[model samples]
Target: MSTKILICIDFSPLTPRIVKTGKELAKALNLGVHLVHAQPEKPSAPTAVVHQGADPSLGREMMKEIKELNNLKSDFEEEDIPCSYATPRGKTSDVIAAEAAKVEAPYIVLGSHGNGAMYHLVVGSVAEGVMKKLDTPVILVPAQQRLDREAGR
Candidate 1:
């Protein structure tokens, strides 16, 4: 059995709910938590026009993501839960599955945006992709439930 639960963080509105679910599961299972943020790969440019130096804006964006991840880690630490994080550049589902495998996590936690079938068919869903790739258990938090409850629907 693995000692930690790997939680996928996309910084979406559903992120907090996903984190909350991860925390609950971690506590129940007496496990640590590892958070992963899949940073999208940057587009390639032709060598002729490529700038020699790294883009300043891209650096700033990375720093911001690091700060957010650190903040989430601190939250878990404050509650006496072991916490760690990683931000890897790649396809979202691939990064998530790779991280889970790397950590040997017992469970993977993430959110479903609850998009309709048309949207999913056109753009694909990360949750679906990750499930297809990993044998590890996944706890998927449904974003639509939270929205509906908040609206008293």
Candidate 2:
């Protein structure tokens, strides 16, 4: 089985950078890429009754994520890079780690939004959480630097 690189992406502005970094690493390593988008678990609404398998709003969100993932996969394919994706709904860190483990990925690539310490303290950091949960080496692409560069700082 060929080793793969697991890349976690979100709707953040840093997602493209993360994908690019992962693509470069995968190309260098001659490995396939597995993209993952972890959606937060849906909160229970006691008053809401669902007649369908899943809530319509959640279904729409999932479809949107899948479409984005497909576009990314197509880009990889155009470059002759093998690619696949998963949209797992759950705690972000747990979902990423689980997918990494499932695929036995050699490396996990993700973006660091570079939020301040106070922000991270209250909101928590997905990159930090994934690092803590997995032994696989993680490639953290810093978002702040990119933002600064874009701003001509």
Residue lDDT tens for model 2, 1-153: 456899999978889989999999999999899999886777432223354445657656667778889999999999999998887879999999999998889999998877788999898998778889998999999896767977999
- In the range 1-153, model 1's lDDT, one tens digit per residue, is 346899999888899999999999999988899999987787422221266655557766768888999999999999889999998879999999999988899899999888889999998998889889988888889997667977999
Give the distance in Å from residue 121's predicted Cα in candidate 1 to where it truly belongs: 1.1
**Who wins the lDDT comparison?**
1
RMSD of each: 3.5, 3.4
lDDT of 1: 0.87
The parts of candidate 2 lying over 4 Å away from their true place are: 43-57, 144-152
Candidate 1 residue spans exceeding 4 A from truth: 43-55, 144-152
Checking candidate 1 for backbone clashes, the offending pairs are none
- How much lDDT does candidate 2 score? 0.86
